[model samples]
Target: MMWKTVLITIFAAGVLADDFSQITAVVTSQCTKNNAEDKVPEVEAALRTFGNCLKGLVDLNVLKTEIEEAKPNGALDEVFKKYCDKSAQLKGCISSVLQGVRPCVGNEYANHINDAQNSTNQLIDFVCYKDGDRIALFIAEGGPECFQQKTENLKTCFLNLKQSFPTVESANNLSLVEKCAKVDEMTSCIVKSLEECSTPTPANMAESLIKFMRKDSPCHTALPVSIV
Candidate 1:
């Protein structure tokens, strides 16, 4: 039984390592591309720091889950407070890496910051300290983990559309639209409306759509969406 436990632990460790490696690869690519062709040391520093914080994220996520399960009095307050604290820490670390890095690296850090912003709210809400926290977290983190899966599907659908797209009329017939049928348009409209509200009414929905329609380029600027 002891040996079996050890093997199980090892297997779990391996899976975690693999997951981290993949995330690292994505970040590294983003950084290296954005930054100049030369600066590698800075990228390494960013990865190490990101990895460290990722460790803390894992712990904090677990801790929050535990608190939620225990349902201690005023536990929600504590959970949210810790979330705010950790989120600030994550932003600072990510900012440090972004500084002096190239554009590719900048993009990487930007995405991480965006993700961090989202995660911050989530931990807080899991404790139910904030109103609308439950609904926000529900769409963002709950519901069969559909957001992640759908995002992946959207990317894939876009790629295929780019590759062997059918006629323009049927372009919207992609796979993502189907599986997310129960949720797609509503979600997209919510984000788009929020984007519009961020700027003046003489806004550019076309530009908004283009920001996504086009490849993620250095020239394009899009409004930030909160994830946490």
Candidate 2:
């Protein structure tokens, strides 16, 4: 029993390290695209702090005593209020500051500031808060032990329809009617692909959902080069 416990602890640590690296890649990629590379260090620092708080919840080391007596949603809400709320507020404040400082930094630098702010807030809302909600739901449904089977059963299904797929009907150009038809086809393809995934959990569901959103979402207009 002692040897088994030690092995489980080592395995869990390895899995956690891999999971954290993947999450870091996703957030850093977004930061680079948004031209906010300088903010990466700060974002990482915040994540580390947040991770410590989360350790308590995940390992049940921090709330072990209280959680047994408390309701699932109630205990989770308490943790969120204590930890996540403060981090969210801090991220929001930093984003606001970046936006506010844009004009003073001159037009040449304004675009960078706007991108930085936009990406930061998006990360906070879409990644941090959304994942937090997922975790809360996981706890409500019986926590990490319950999710082990879910993670094993979950399948990530992706159907990539290139931009040219819709345009190809008109020799790399799409008519209004053709565009609408292609959009319908794309939607159907995605639905069919999802149907094939055997029992998806929240973590698996996000992979394709975010990709689809990014594919269809409008990009910000490129900033004009400033005349000297």
lDDT against the true structure, each candidate: 0.40, 0.44
C-alpha-based local distance difference test score of model 2: 0.44
Q: Ten consecutive residues with minimal summed lDDT in candidate 2?
A: 219-228
Residue pairs whose backbone atoms clash in candidate 2: none
Worst 10 residues of 1 by lDDT: 1-10
TM-score computed on alpha carbons, candidate 2: 0.32
TM-score of each: 0.39, 0.32
Clash count list over all predictions: 12, 0
RMSD of 1: 13.7
Residue 11's lDDT in candidate 2:
27
- In the range 91-179, model 1's lDDT, one tens digit per residue, is 56444443423334344244444433334334333333353333233332332234343455446534543344345334346453342
RMSD of each: 13.7, 13.8
